[model samples]
Target: MQIKLIAIGKTDNSNLITLIEDYTKRLSFYIKFDFEIIPDIKNVKHLSEAQQKDKEGELILAKTQTSDILILLDENGKQMDSVAFSSYLQKHMNSGIKTLIFVIGGPYGFSNALYNRANGKLGLSKMTFSHQMVRLFFIEQLYRGFTILRNEPYHHR
Candidate 1:
């Protein structure tokens, strides 16, 4: 199955981009992986919180096909260990999912519409993280998940 990570805005920090690229490259060997960045809304301060998320949600929803399973990266979402995450991925692959679309929402969070569309939500940690930093974390976890699946040395039990 193809795995797509759809996030808003580019990572301005060159160092973070390099790390994200490194993990993304590693993940490609295990599964079809696409990391897409939706441009940040211009002059966002003028828009209300819900307004920004509503507009961003439209763009996020547009990226997915009907067959895609949308997963949100949310603080209040389910949390899993590395091994469990690998199994979760394996189960989805076994089910023949066309595409697994995981989303990292905007700074203000997701709109009600986006929340309604999501099939599931995953929490990396209870601690809050910067949206840019979450991109790196998610990519790295994805790489680690694949490594665990392959019994690679990258993730130690």
Candidate 2:
């Protein structure tokens, strides 16, 4: 199955972009991986937090297809270890889905509609992380998961 990560806003830090690209390239060797960035919502200063989330949610929803399984990267999501996450990836692949999409929402997080639409929610950590950093961490974890699935030395037992 093809895996896609969709996040809002551009990552301006050159160092973070380079690292994210490195992992993305590494991940391509195992599966079709796509990283998409939704431009940040303009005039956010004029909008309420709820309104901002609503607008961002609409953009996020528009990127997805009806057949896609959407998973939100939420702070309150189900947290799992690396091995369990690898198994989760394996399960999705075994299910024969075309694409599994994971979304990293904007500053205020997701909208009510997005929460209702998600098939699942995953938390990378109990601690908060910047959206840009999450991209790198998540991609590297994807690479690690694939390596673990292959019994490679990338992940320590």
Best of the candidates, lDDT: 2
Residues 1-157 of candidate 2: C-alpha lDDT, one tens digit per residue: 9999999999999999999999999999999999999999999999999999999999999999999999999999999999999999999999999999999999899999999999999999999999889999999999999999999998989
Scored by TM-score, the top model is: 2
Q: How many backbone clashes does candidate 1 have?
A: 0
Q: Which residue ranges in model 2 land beyond 4 Å of their true spot?
A: none
RMSD of each: 0.7, 0.6
Provide TM-scores for the models.
0.98, 0.99
lDDT of 1 by residue, 29-56 (tens): 9989999999999998899999999999
Error in Å for residue 83 of model 1:
0.7
TM-score of predicted model 2?
0.99
Weakest ten-residue segment in model 1 by summed lDDT: 22-31
Looking at model 2, report the run of 10 residues with the lowest lDDT sum: 128-137
Q: lDDT of each model, Cα atoms only?
A: 0.94, 0.96
Per model, state how many residue pairs clash.
Answer: 0, 0
